[model samples]
Target: MPNSEFSGCRWAVVLLVMAAASPSWAAPIEQSDTPLPADCDGLKKLSLPLEDAPPASMASSLKGCSSEDLYFGIGVPKDPVRARQCAYVERQDPDNGWPNLFAGTGMLMTIYANGIGAPRNFDIAMKFACELGGAPAEEEGWLAHLQKLKNENWQGQDFSPCDDITSGAAMGFCEAHGAKLASAARKAKLADITAHWPSAERKAFAALEKAKNTYAAAVADNEVDMSGTARGALSIAAREAEDEQFLATLEKVISGNLPSVSPPDLAETDNKLNALYSKIQKKKDTSDWGTVTKAGIKKTERTWLIYRDAFVSFAKRNFPSVAPESLKRVLTEDRIKSLENFGN
Candidate 1:
């Protein structure tokens, strides 16, 4: 497999939304007339660490909770789940066409071809890799690997019944538990990392903290021009790009400080959402639609996507200067809870 097998079989998504009660916004890090460290090396000089990570844990440092394993366990090399997932994430940014950037989809295809967590299917792997855009060399290698897995007659696996949380009450409880657990985990993680920080990186650590504080202040000051235009979008994109870089620096430093800490699996959050969505489909599929057209189910899904995008976009306009991924995530998390539990 070139990198598509889902280890822990769970994915992680990081939505960086500004959380503030105030409506004022501003540029947190004042860009110097002399462009300060734009790349990791430059940023490293600034004492800020950064790493290239895959989006949504598709092939990532971020881990997802698995109902099967019940947890996205640590110990990457030893853990079957972690090893498989880590395989999906390649370290070659130059090959991916994005300088210093990891290819999210390319890694996924690798997993499929290698049969990391799922079945070894060359056709499926190639299909996904093509969709994700790729370097041809990866595809050829993946093809060969899939053939190898096939020769061994490697079997595939699916999520066990325990992995599927169908009950509304159960899922809801799980979400609450997840939220609480995440909060504690984050606090502990931050404390643990800081405690272990070496003196050489103290300046870098302070800079990172200042960046975080300023970003928070900016998010709070949201009283900015909400005009939606190409120019505004570009401006937002620029700032968001900076924010992403700042975040990457933080990730790198933390990894440096504490090599043992693993990214979250976020199974609780995902399971609830997946179950609710599945229930909706099952209900629609088995429904006695009466006057409602059978096409309504799929239409509803499509419409929901459109609505979600628009709604998030609008909410994001208020800030117009930061990434709305976090807002989208919060909204998404809330939505699963609000969804009509068909299984109930």
Candidate 2:
């Protein structure tokens, strides 16, 4: 058999075992309450101010400029003639006017920090940072920029110092401002995705419902031995329904076959199943069917852990190697300093 097919079968077995063993009440562990990092306080105080405007004529010429322009403008090649042409175009099209100077300035600061146009030049970096610190309109732009950073495809990037620095800076700035911003953004995105989830959820529910019906029929016919696969399939279907995105995509595939079920209803069903699994596992009788189910669930959990570890190992292996000294200074030294200065 093909390797891919073998892997798929292996994963199915793993999932089946985990689902059987998992306690109905097995919820994700919550994080412990740790004190906020000390350097976090100082980093919070670091604000970017906007620098003075360009010459009146130059500013006019940049009228129709955009965030993209601002991104390219700072330290980008300047052609007075082309800029004049752009200004003329801006005069003709008011709706597509150039990006606000402050927004552009913020964008420039981001670009510099990200090392987009140049190598890691801390001098220019400090300049733009100081500019952002001074700019009044920079707050909104900076916040929006940070959101963009959060949404960045980090896994796809080459992962250079330039890119990573901007990411770290964006994260630090967001944290300094308030970690709530990141949390709120994540929640908002999740909400948006969940809002349109009815169809996907309905489809998942139908699949589970079908599985349940099938199992019930098997039991009625006294075919208990043949019901294991159906029960396993039901567990998988129910779990898939709980995954907002997966359900949404699956809904498309089984469009007309979906039942009229909401996400909340599906969620409740999942919770009930989890609780049932937990109850079964707690039973003392080792020779009972509940024990067999619990064992299968344990196997599933182990398989999931193995799968997770494999991906993590793959990521670690593929990650680009950076200079040890650079890593130590950037990741460790700066963090240590930030912590040391936090309360002071």
TM-score of candidate 2 on Cα atoms, chains taken together = 0.21
Give the alpha carbon lDDT tens digit for every residue of 141-198 in model 1: 4344444444555564321111222222222222333333343444456666667656
Question: 74-138 in candidate 2: lDDT tens per residue?
Answer: 22353333433342333234242122122333334443334443332222333333333332233
TM-score of each: 0.21, 0.21
Q: What is the C-alpha RMSD of each candidate to the true structure, in Å?
A: 25.5, 25.3
Show the lowest summed lDDT stretch of 10 residues, model 2: 4-13
Q: Candidate 2: which stretches are off by over 4 Å?
A: 1-106, 113-122, 134-344
Compared to the true structure, candidate 1 yields what TM-score?
Answer: 0.21
Ten contiguous residues with the weakest lDDT in model 1: 15-24
